[model samples]
Target: MTTGGIARQVVLRAAATAAGPALLLRRWTTADADALVEAYRDPVLRAWTRLGVPDAGAAVRWVEAQRTGWEGGGRLSFAVVEEEPGGGRVAGNVVLKRPEPAGPAGEVGYWTAAHARGRGVAPRALQVLTDWVFETFAGQGLEYLELMHQVDNTASCRVAEKAGYGFERVLPAVPPFPRDGHLHLRWATGGPVPG
Candidate 1:
């Protein structure tokens, strides 16, 4: 299928405004179940996401949970589709999760589909999402965007670099992984100017 066809099937129209040429950043939808299954079932995706292999039922539940997060507020998950000649296929996913009580800092996370790897999709999606966060929620104190990648995931680090986020530092005690854990990298954007 063409990328446009995949986009029409995978991308939510409401979130289309947040899209760019190389990628589409859209809100999660219940209807995304099928595409979610197709994308998430890839072994590479499972590795990067750390979400484990999902059955069809599990995939449905996962997409539903993402939608729930939107309704609940303070979290925004976007489906990233690569724009090909005839539109684009669902390349992967990205997220801008607002931190509680931290004020204006958003944590960013992303994963690219196996087929779309090495094609510059993730960084492009990140740039669009970052721009959208600044424009849509800057008034609400959106200041910095932070990302953490498994040090072993060199490709992800490259994407962060391409998107203009500097290497911050490696921190220990990171949760969901290990105490002696993943390296943390942070980038500040759209925050109040210092005195």
Candidate 2:
């Protein structure tokens, strides 16, 4: 598989004015550490995603880890930033990791920032990421994507549904987490996966 050139230029569609500016899925940078630290401080985010950046230093480490993961293969991480005047805010993150290089599947994970929640950000960001991945990596052998969330996370389930991921089944005894979770699947369409 072509690892180095995985996501050279995968920009998603520009959002309509009524919705918002086009969502940009770019690689995380050190400048985003502060926002990431603040985003992880959200109680709801910590409770659900269990990710906590804690401080700017740790946030920088987290961002660096994501970059290393991309460089090492098997992972692709993007900051979900909304387009606005004078740059944009770090709204959230969407990541595809644990890729099966020789297989046709990968896992996706995401979380919306506290201030960005409830504005259709997560679902729309996920939709764009999913579409970009399937289209850009099709020739590299990617075929399907999988998303799993705590069964009790109704909001995440809704996001998966809105992003066109079909409910597959409940995966039991998932390691690192005790509770059973719902498994959602979205296969790559010839074009963008319809949401």
Candidate 3:
């Protein structure tokens, strides 16, 4: 999808992790439907995630939505996959969304499947996504990325920190969910990013 004046595809090599399988960040596909269904079966995932892709059919719609978003120049969604001997397993998802393409900023959001939790999947995938965004959109006016999570979600806090996004501020309660939220940010630098 086109964001902040740049357009590029998401491709990734295996990202090394502390434990478990290597991670790969790539565009979402309909083939990921079954995995999406299984991942959503986790109560934690269902409660935390905004999109409710509870079944294969719904997951297909979710993938189609991403494709539509990409074609319409809005959000870019990636499937976070873990590499194993037989093949890659869908571990979770990460998305970069820009409400205003003319703006110089965007928001990042992620979730890790139950099996992928505690294995550094979210942070590793987010780090790669952040790097790709800055590198691919360097001269296209993309300057900053932001992430928000419920203050009580300590795991998400850790993910933000591990991904090198500085905690910006704690936003007050907002709506039905995500009360006591914290805002995190990462600015583009010409050199290597920390995490």
C-alpha lDDT of all candidate models, in order? 0.66, 0.82, 0.83
Candidate 3 per-residue lDDT over residues 1-195, each given as its tens digit: 554344656577555656877887888888888998899899998878776876788989988998887776678888988888888888888888977766788899999999888888888889888988788767767789999999889999999999999999999987766578999999887323577
Alpha carbon deviation, residue 99, candidate 3 (Å): 2.0
C-alpha TM-scores of all predictions = 0.77, 0.89, 0.89
- What residue runs in model 2 are displaced by over 4 Å at the alpha carbon? 1-3, 7-14, 17-19, 190-195
Q: Give the TM-score of candidate 2.
A: 0.89
Question: What C-alpha lDDT, on a 0 to 100 scale, does residue 14 get in candidate 1?
Answer: 19
Looking at model 2, which ten-residue stretch has the lowest summed lDDT?
A: 8-17
Q: Residue 135 deviation, candidate 1, in Å?
A: 1.5
Residue by residue across 1-195, what tens digits does model 1's lDDT show? Answer: 322111222343212324434566676665666777778778777776768536667767777767665655556678876555876677778887764624857788888877777767787788777666666665666567788877777887889888777777766655776533244344344233676
Cα lDDT tens digits for candidate 2, 1-195: 344666544455437345566677788889999899899888899888755799998998999898887887678888988888898888889988855666778889899898888787888888888877777677877778899998988999999998989999998866677688999998886334566
The 10-residue segment of model 1 with minimum total lDDT is 1-10
Model 1's alpha-carbon lDDT is 0.66
